[model samples]
Target chain A: MREIQAEEITSVVAEAIKNINFHIRPDVKAELQRALEEEASPLGRQSLQLLLENAQMAAAGVLPLCQDTGTTVIFAEVGQEVRIVGASLEEALQAGVRLATREGRLRHSIAVHPLSRGNSGDNTPAVVHYHPIPGKALKLFVMAKGGGCENASAMAMLPPLASRHGVGDYIVNIIRTNGAAACPPLIIGIGLGGNFETAPLLAKRALLRKIGEFSPDPETAKLEKVLLRRINELGIGPQGWGGSITALSVSIETAPCHIASLPVAVNVECHSHRLTEVKI
Target chain B: MSATWLKLPLEPLVLRDLKVGQWVNLSGSLYTARDAALKQIFDLEADNKQPPVDLKGQLIYFVGPTPPAPGESVGSAGPTTSRRMEHFIPALIEAGVSGIMGKGPLSQSTVKELQRKGIIYLAAAGGAGAFYGSKVRGATITAYEELGPEAIYCMHIENFPAVVAIDLEGGDLFEQGPKTYRKET
Candidate 1:
């Protein structure tokens, strides 16, 4: 068994939160560069240029890449052979986020209550998902997901007979209608074949994949390509100002499901696309 | 293509000349507000009370900037989705606000109201908050300090860039720009 100290987890989480906010992942940056060259609209191209500059400035520590440093969404895969010392995993992660929010000067965006509309002040209680893996190591994926893009996410439970094209159509329609609001060019994450709740979770998890990387499954990879082409053709352009590069990349993840259902969810991410992974 | 440099508290005539798809580099003073600030303004107006800041002939940016790092004028500040503020826009326009700056498209009814009032809607690059925030020369929270980042801030900006997404004549670049390039595949 591998024993990990809770302070170690806290430090890693804190560093991940702070670093991810200031830095755009290199793969996502490369995609933006490609979009800059390929975009035909003058305004769209200009938007991409500014996005690139923003990434550079953010990395230089001038400011975070986005004002909405985002709701901290963490995915942890803990091995059964690993044991945490001193504190619970959840408390450690929350403490790390709280420290990052203070040290990084990030906005306190979390509302204490959804109805009463109270501010959480420290941006604590990260939305965390945990899965048990077989190895002795623990893996963590963290994303600072902006509210604009989060609000644009959608899901549908289609009839069993709905073809792959129908799924593609639904995804395309959601982007077409809500793409601008989410901030294009977007990174699209799709979850297919899961039940209702898991479908949305899978969709969001799919976004953790590096930009431009395709699923290993051939059929799923092809679907990613097709959907990428279809979404870009929507001409929502960069920042939805209009152009040929609406989406930078499309990633899809799938799981087995009931015989009567085809549940799909689309989670849209903004161009900032701040996410990082750590293993211990 | 070419960006036009303009100063804020833009005149009605100056706003009338802006068309959808035109780039602008704005400078001068403007007020910031988001969902919470807008709601407060609406409530105060409904109660026949005046807001803390004047709305007449001013520009308002829909943004909730991150807290500034030490010695910085502002933190990464960019336009939020404008659709959420649509309901408050007509009221703002009626109060004599000449221009709105945000990201994404506004509702058709909001566009109509903007046209009726001869105001314009500009879109800054979403997710490019760091770049935009750098343009802010000064910022002071003007109202609703309790709302934290959502509070109203009077900001002095220099050469802040945006595109005229909706014009005074009601030309919506969000619709027209896409239609111009969309391939009917």
Candidate 2:
């Protein structure tokens, strides 16, 4: 069995947190740039330009891209043949987040209680989802969910008769109704055909797909393209000034569902789209 | 158009002069607060208790920034959603806050309140936290430090950037612009 020290995992988490704060991944950057080129609304183009500038400034100066640095969500895939040494894995991850919060100069947004409300100074005790995978290496993906777009996420279970057209209509309606509150030039993550809760998970997971990357399945890819065109047509321009580039991308993940159920989930992400990953 | 700057201890200014797209750089003493903090302030007002800060002509920033590291003045101090604070806003205006700074839409009631009180609401670019943080030169806690980032912080800013989202006439950029440009079938 391969043995990994607790300090090693802590270091990985620390670096991943720091990296996501300042530098958005390359694929994400490229997508935002592409949207800027196609944006029809002058205001939309301007908003995109500001977004690009924000990213550049954050990276060059080693500062946070958005004031809402978000709650740290960790998805870890642990290998079966590996043994954790030094300290409990959870504690090590929290320690890593604590170190990153201090060193990276990140915002501590996590509240101590949902009702009473108090900030956890270090941003520690990350939201961790662990899965045992068939591998000798551990992989972790960290997502920081800002409140603006995260508050707009929703899920609904439709009847089996809900057609692809119905699904499209539902999604478009939600985005239309939510408007700029979700932040225009948004990324929509749609999960279809899964159980209720898992549908949302699939939708969020789909967000990790490359910006503007089409699904491999022809039908799904066509849906993504059509939805992209329709949303931009809303003219919710950049910052909702009425524009052509309303949505940056739409990613969908699907799984088999019960014959009587059509579970759909929509997770909207702001232009910030902050996420990072590491394999150790 | 020439740019103008304002200092704290402000006197009432006509909202008529503020244009839809004009840029403004604000300075002087501003208080930091958001939804939770706003709610608390309103609750105190309801009980006839004095609020933590003297808000007459005071500028309240709708932000709950991240904790600054050991040596920085503040962390990405960007605006939070304005819609969430809608319920508390009219009361804040009634209580004498001259300005509110945040992003996104404001409630109709908020717009009305701004007009009635000759107040203003501004929008800072949503994601430009780093750029905005540079404008904050100093900060101090006047109340609710236990609330951490959500606490009411008295901040001194220099040349902070924002656009007039809601002027004294109840004209709101968010409502008017979107309605004009919304696509029709």
Candidate 3:
């Protein structure tokens, strides 16, 4: 077994958390630039320009791209071949989050409880999900999801008879109601055919996809295009400032569900769309 | 006549146009407080004790900035939801806060109160943290160190760009703008 020091994991995780807040990923940047060219709405085009400018400023001067640095949601793929030597893996990750909150100067957006609502100043413990993988390197996918886009997310359980059209209608309605509230030119990530909670998770996972990239399945890609076209028709515009392009792209993911249940979920990402992945 | 219009940034258009949201930004003073800080301000007022900072015609940002690294002004400074502080806004307005800066919607009650009190709620673009951070030329804590990120920070700003969400006359961009564009589906 390859031995990896827990301290090393902690340090890497800390830097990863910090780097994501301060920098926009190259892939996301490229996509924003492309969207600027394709966006027809003069207002959307302007909003995209500001977004690009914000990304550039944040990257160069070490400013946070958006104010809501958000909670540290870390997706860890642990290598079965690697053994952590010093501290507990969970503790190490939590430590990394603490360091990021304190040192990185990222916002402490996490509340202790949904009902009681107490602030957890350090933004810990992180929402860490671990999966075993056959490799020597640990992969961490860190995303800082702001509350605006997060608030726009929807999960619904439709009957088996729910047609593709029905699901599409629901997704469009969500964006229309959300209006400028979700910070438009959003990335609409849709998940179809999964259990309740799993469906939302799948939708969020779909957002990890690079902007404008398509699903491997032609059917899913076609559906994505249709949804994208319908959403932009709503005229939500950038910052709700008025525009033609409501969304930059749409991505859909699906997994088999119970024969009786047709579940659907939508996770909208604002223009900032902050996320990054690191392997160590 | 009851007076309450010392609030400099009057409306969304005026605020940006008058350069209240412009560069030169601000150098001398500003106040930092959030939900909890507002409560403390009111609590002190209720007790007939002086609130820590003087908010006369002063700018107050509704932010709980991240902890600063060694030798930094402040980290990732950005506005929090103004709607959350709706309950405490009237009191703050009455107490003489000139400008309120935050993101998202303000409650109708808060909008009415701002109109009555002649105050304005500014909407800094949400998720424009880095852009927002660039305007903060300097920062230091003046109260509630225990509040950490939510502590009262005295921030110096330069040409900070923010849209007027709530104006002195009760016009709110967050309300009127979206309501205009909200399609009947």
Top model by lDDT, which number? 1
iRMS value of model 3? 5.3
lDDT of 3 at A122: 81
Candidate order, lDDT descending? 1, 2, 3
lDDT (10s digit) by residue, model 2, range A1-280: 9899999999989988888888877877887788788766555566677778778878864569887888888888899988889998888889999988888877788878898766688886688888899869888888877888888788899889988889888888878766577666788899998897789988888887878789999999999998887777676666765667778899989999999999999998887888887899
lDDT by residue (B1-185, candidate 2, tens digit) is: 23456665445664467755456777888898987778889899889888888887888888877667467667778788888888888678767887888877777776886778788887777877777777788888888887777889888888876777888767777777666666646
**Can you tell me the CAPRI class of model 2?**
medium
Identify the runs in model 3 with alpha carbons over 4 angstroms from their true place. A38-47, A113-121, A135-137, B1-29, B39-59, B96-99, B106-117, B166-185
The clash count for each model shown is 1, 5, 6
Candidate 3, residue A34: how far the Cα is off, in Å: 3.3
TM-scores for all candidates: the values are 0.98, 0.93, 0.82
Q: Which parts of model 2 are misplaced by more than 4 Å?
A: B1-11, B69-71
In the range B1-185, model 3's lDDT, one tens digit per residue, is 11122223323344433311211233345787897788888788888778888877677888876555467687667677666677777667767877787766666777787777667666666666766677777888899876666778888776665555666667766555544444435
lDDT of 1 by residue, A151-270 (tens): 999999999889889999999999999998898999999999889899999999999998889999999999999999999888889888889999989999999999999999999999
Q: Is 2 or 3 the stronger prediction by TM-score?
A: 2
By summed lDDT, which 10 consecutive residues of candidate 2 chain A come out lowest? A39-48
Question: Which runs in model 1 stand beyond 4 Å of their true positions?
Answer: none
List clashing residue pairs in candidate 2.
A44-A238, A107-B66, A235-A243, A237-A242, A237-A243
DockQ for every prediction shown: 0.83, 0.55, 0.29
Candidate 3 per-residue C-alpha lDDT over A1-280 given as tens digits, one digit per residue, 9 for 90 to 100: 8898888888888888778887887877777777678765553465577677788787863567776787677788999998988898899899998887767667777789886667787888688878899979888888888776788788889888887888898888888766467767688788898899888888888888888898999988988888888887665666654456678788899999999999999998887776888888
Clashes of 2: 5
User: Is candidate 1 or 2 superior in lDDT?
Assistant: 1
Arrange candidates, best TM-score first: 1, 2, 3
